[model samples]
Target: MKEENLIVRSVTKKKYSSYAGEITPATPNLIQRNFKAEAPDKK
Candidate 1:
């Protein structure tokens, strides 16, 4: 039980950090660009 709690706490902290990192102003546009780039080639 104690080990599980520690693992959950560490995962939660990392998730929060990742969430904070993802909300930056540049994130959306970069994601959109990459998404477009990855689409099937129109040929």
Candidate 2:
């Protein structure tokens, strides 16, 4: 990408504050960092 003068656009991150101090259920990691794909360009 550098050779083609390509650049990556980044998203601006905003914080969510709903129920910030309340007790809530924990979120699960379904994939668990296993990002392998059977074919190229597939998630």
Candidate 3:
């Protein structure tokens, strides 16, 4: 292969992203980063 001067092609993998886009949420943020609750298994 070296003497023949042959080359091989390669494909690169696409990068993954978590960004969806600018859009309104389906439901309102009821938690609002509030994880504490009055009782256990409440929140």
- In model 2, the runs with Cα more than 4 Å from the true position are 1-19, 39-43
Candidate 3 local accuracy as lDDT? 0.91
Q: Regarding lDDT, does 2 or 3 come out ahead?
A: 3
Poorest stretch of ten by lDDT in candidate 2? 15-24
> How would you encode candidate 1's per-residue C-alpha lDDT over 1-43 as one tens digit per residue?
7866654344444333434445555444534445454457732
Best candidate according to lDDT: 3
TM-scores, all models, native as reference: 0.12, 0.30, 0.34
lDDT (CA) for every model shown?
Answer: 0.48, 0.85, 0.91
Candidate 2, lDDT over the whole model: 0.85
**Per-residue error (Å), model 3, residue 5:** 50
RMSD of 3: 5.4
Error of 2 at 16 (Å): 18
lDDT of 3 by residue, 1-43 (tens): 8999999989999899989999886998889999989999997
Ranking by lDDT: 3, 2, 1
Residue 18's lDDT in candidate 2 = 75
